[model samples]
Target: MSAALVLDFGGPVLLTPFELVADQPGTPAYELLHQRGPLATAEQPDQVWEDLQAGRITERAYWDARAEQWHESGGEEPDIRAMIAHLYDPPRPELVREHARALVRDAREAGRRIGILTNDLRAFHSEEWIERIEIVGDMDVVVDGSVEGHLKPDPRLYELLAERLGVSYAEMVFLDDQRTNIRGAEALGIASVWFDVTDPDTSYAEVRQLLGLPPDGAQHG
Candidate 1:
């Protein structure tokens, strides 16, 4: 009665720039303002964040618009994009790396099969970020959203992963930083752990305990 484990990459294993926006106060809300001008006061920050996340507007477009608006308003400032980049550039959090690799390690020692389930774009596949990470056991399968064009929160993605692993949804354990993603897996009868991601001090040992794995197999920092 071995278990199956699926891990999500974003928030859990990587620090995205959008998550660090609050850290950069000097950067204009829109990159265009610094490059060309300032943004109208009516434009909301949340809207900008969404547009950036969805890739609705190019970073350069936003910066250019900001620069124009700021200049028209007679505000003097530097380029916002460069300033924000310095604050929120994506970097691998070592704690995330350590524990994520450990999660794979623990699952292997518990005699469980391992795989990765992540929402990513073409770059993630092209860059081989999945292959770069060292998992303790062999990754039996990979269900990436960008490759399949079917992202998570869609139960089909989870189903596809289970099919490739040759396991029932009820037999799999899903780990994700997002609660919505976790709920999606649960709806399909997959056991789940809501990884806080930023903290890295998750109760993953409890998951091992539930699987009846030896305590020594679980790693704690």
Candidate 2:
């Protein structure tokens, strides 16, 4: 049976600024990086991140909350926009993408459905960024957490994706870097691939093999 390929945008398909933090953990550039990701610190829950993704909280509001949290922890006043800007205002480079793009092209050409399910509504929905990424046009569906008001691990989001893809939940092969998100999809009967997202070759190779596609679909992939 032809299956729908459901991919998580950030870590699985392409690396983002948040995942890049570990590389420069001790530098001046990395100090505010600690205030990144869904859970900025170990003690804080991901509630604010969820709110940001779900459109319940504005971007500025989310940062304000982070700032308040920092003060509570006895950290001095933080430059919230500086950190947010560092992530948002970058030349977004690809960690790995060519093979993934080829797979999308080939799969679509062969009549299989493709979709991206991400907590990244902010960028993918934006005209400029979507054009920059170049896969938005190729995808049969794009599920943005903010637009949908439902983030991943929420069964409703998967249901919406299946509806949009015109496929059953199980017919979609879901791939994500986070284990919790993988388990969430699995709970609803979707076969999930736990991607080691930081390592491009391994994760991409596994995805290629799983989809029954040739090794390195792109010329340089």
Model 2, residue 209: distance off in Å is 2.7
For candidate 2, the per-residue lDDT at 71 reads: 50
- The global C-alpha lDDT for each of the candidates, from Candidate 1 onward, is 0.58, 0.67
Q: Write the per-residue lDDT of candidate 2 for residues 19-132, one digit (tens) a residue.
A: 665566665445544456542656754666666556566545656676555455544555554444444444354543665677677677667789999865463335565566
Candidate 1 residue 64 Cα shift, in angstroms, is 17
* Cα RMSD for candidates in order: 8.5, 6.1
Among all windows of ten consecutive residues in candidate 1, which has the lowest summed lDDT? Answer: 32-41
**Model 2: how far residue 102 lies from native, Å:** 3.2
lDDT (10s digit) by residue, model 1, range 1-221: 54787777655454433444334446543332222111223443445534633546543454455445555544455444333334333423341455455666777766787777876533233344333444512577777876787767778899889989888887887777556677788888888887653445544555555556545433553
Candidate 2 worst ten-residue window by lDDT = 82-91
- Summed over model 2, clashes come to 0
Query: Compared to the true structure, candidate 1 yields what TM-score?
Result: 0.60
